[model samples]
Target: MFAFCADPKTLEGAAWFACYLTSATHLAMYWSVLTVMLLLALAAPSALMFGFGGALMARSHIPPLAWVGKGYISMVRGVPDIVFFLFVPIAVDQGLEYLMHVTRCADWTEPVRRGADFVVCPQAKIPQSTAPAYVHDAYAFALALLAFALVFGAFAANTLKGAMEAVPRAQVETAEAYGMNRAQAFRRIILPQMWVYALPGLTNLWMILVKATPLLFLLGIQDIVYWARELGGSKTQVYAYPHPDWRVWYFLALLVFYLGLTWASERVFARVQNRLSVGQATAAGEALRKAGAA
Candidate 1:
């Protein structure tokens, strides 16, 4: 903020816009972009880990474990994403509070589900309803991240399962025949080969994940979309910086932001795809080899 910003009504043209942009609220809006990025950065890996576990379970020798894993993948992916987006965070939060209530407030005799209000001992409340602002924000973001991970993880599991199955059965058997155990064969042959097949599906998943960042608003996090609406709404002249409805411009900025994100993501995935295509038997690999030879 500048001295001019102290009385924003006196500012005009670029100066007015400059001060407006640098206001504390605008800075928070800008930082919200980083929140989206952090979610993606964290969620992608978490989803992959969950997917890997699910895929392993789906293919497990134990019938019950395989059923549970397959069921998870089927159930999550089969359900509509919006439902999960709305449902998961609330369910997880309440579930956690309930568990804590049992442990921390065992002596409390009141029913938790009191006429549709999910009440718990105040001591068992997550963040205790009295923690710092940042703690509440962190708790909300963590729940949103978990929702993303669970939904995306199921989809990733399906993709990975197909990729794993796509590896040739003969090759696996031959590798085992040549003194490699099942684990060694899987690590050396199947694992390396599956990526080329998996990359395409995984790349699409990444894009979908990127697009879904806007859903943070539904999860109680004050994300960029929330800021855009708050800051871009028309303010009357009674306010220091009066402005007409500028939501169009704010949303246009969002459009450009997302387009740029997807553009950068495509370039990254393309490079990764090309990198994975080197020196293998697939058509893309063969083409890459020829290109290298030339």
Candidate 2:
């Protein structure tokens, strides 16, 4: 910020605007974008891992495991995502707190659910009552991340399970004929081949996750959406830089940001799919071979 920015009250026009934009609150707003990115970066891989586990469970020989996996996939599909987004964090938080309460306060006589209140001892509170403000925020964010992962993972599981099954039965039969066990055949043939099939659905899910980042506001995280609303509200003469409601512009910026993210991700995923198909027995690979021969 320039020296003139030191006296914001006396500043006007572009100088005042620049100063305002570079203020502490605005800096925090800028950093929140990175927070969103960090969440996506961390959550995507975690969700994929969860999805892989779920898919394996669905394919398990154990009937109960298969049932549980199938139920998880189906339940998520049937419910509206926003409902899960709202419910998952609260449920996970309370569940954690409840477990802690039972462990830490074994002698407490009070029932946890006394008319809709989830009462837990102060010692069992996540981040603890004595913890700093940011600790509470971080704990909340972690819960939100878990919620996002669980919901998205269920969808990913369904996609992966279908993809895994879509890998040619003939391939598995050949592997078995060669004395390969089911596990060996799955590891050597199915896992690698299934990815080409799964990539499309997974890419779509990634886009959906990107779009859903705005829901961080709903989770009480101070994300871009929250900052947009806060900064874009009308400011009166009582403030350093009085302005009318500019929410439309703020939202428009968010739209552009998301559009850019999706567009870039599409380009990246397309290249990855092409690379993954290079030596495969798929139609895309066959086409590439034909082109190379020509």
Candidate 3:
């Protein structure tokens, strides 16, 4: 911020606009791109872990565990992701508050739910009602992240399950014949080979995750889309940075941001696909084989 930015009123033209763009709020808005990226970074691996668990459970010899795994994978197919995105955080939050209420407010005889209201003792509040703004924001973010992980985890579970099955049956049999137990075969042989098959589905999931970042707004996080709508709205002369409606321009920038992300992800996944394909028995591997020989 320049000295001129101290008085946005005196400024004019691009300089005025530049100062406005660099304003504290706008800077925060700009940094929200990183928030989206951070969400993806955290959510992707977390979801993958959840997916791996689900896939493993799905393939379990035990009937109950197998049913749970299959149910986990099948849940997404019947339900819309947006519905999960909306419902999961509230469910988790209320579930936590309910548990806390039971543990911390046992003396209170009042009902936890009265009509449509969900009321809990102050001690049962997540981050507490008196907590700092940042604490509240962080709590909301954590819930959103969990929701993302659970929903995407289901998709990932399905993909990983198929990938596991796609690993040649003969290879698994050979591992078993070589004195390897089921777990050892999965770890040393099946798991390694499944990645090549899983990579395509995972890549698609990554792209879907990127697009879905905008839904963070629906979850009440002040993500990039939230800032775009906020900053693009008209500000009066009394405000530090007065501006006309610029939602179109702001959204165009978001479009560019997402396009760039998609392009970068494609390039990265291409490299990863190639790397995973090395020495595999697939079309990509065959191509790499001929090229290496040539």
Return the lDDT, model 1, position 141. 92
Question: Per-residue lDDT tens digits of candidate 2, residues 1-294?
Answer: 678887788888888889999988889999999999999998899889889999999999999999999888889889998899899998888989999999999998888888978899888888798999989988988988988999999989999999999999999999999999999999999998999999999999999999899899889899999999999999898877778999899989999999899999999999999998898888988987898899
Residue 282's lDDT in candidate 1:
86
TM-score of each: 0.97, 0.95, 0.96
* Of 1 and 2, the candidate ranking higher by TM-score: 1
lDDT assessment of candidate 1: 0.92
Instruction: For each candidate in turn, give its C-alpha RMSD to the true structure in angstroms.
Output: 1.2, 1.5, 1.3
Cα lDDT tens digits, model 3, 103-140, are 99999999988999999999998979899998998899
lDDT string, candidate 1, 1-294, tens digits? 878788887889999999989989999998999999999999999999999889989988899999999999999988999899999999989999999999999899989998879999988899877799999999999999999999999999999999999999999999989999988998999999998888899999999999999899999888999999998999998877789999999999999999999999999989988888887778899999888899
* Model 1: residue 291 alpha-carbon error in angstroms: 1.2
Clashing pairs in 1: none
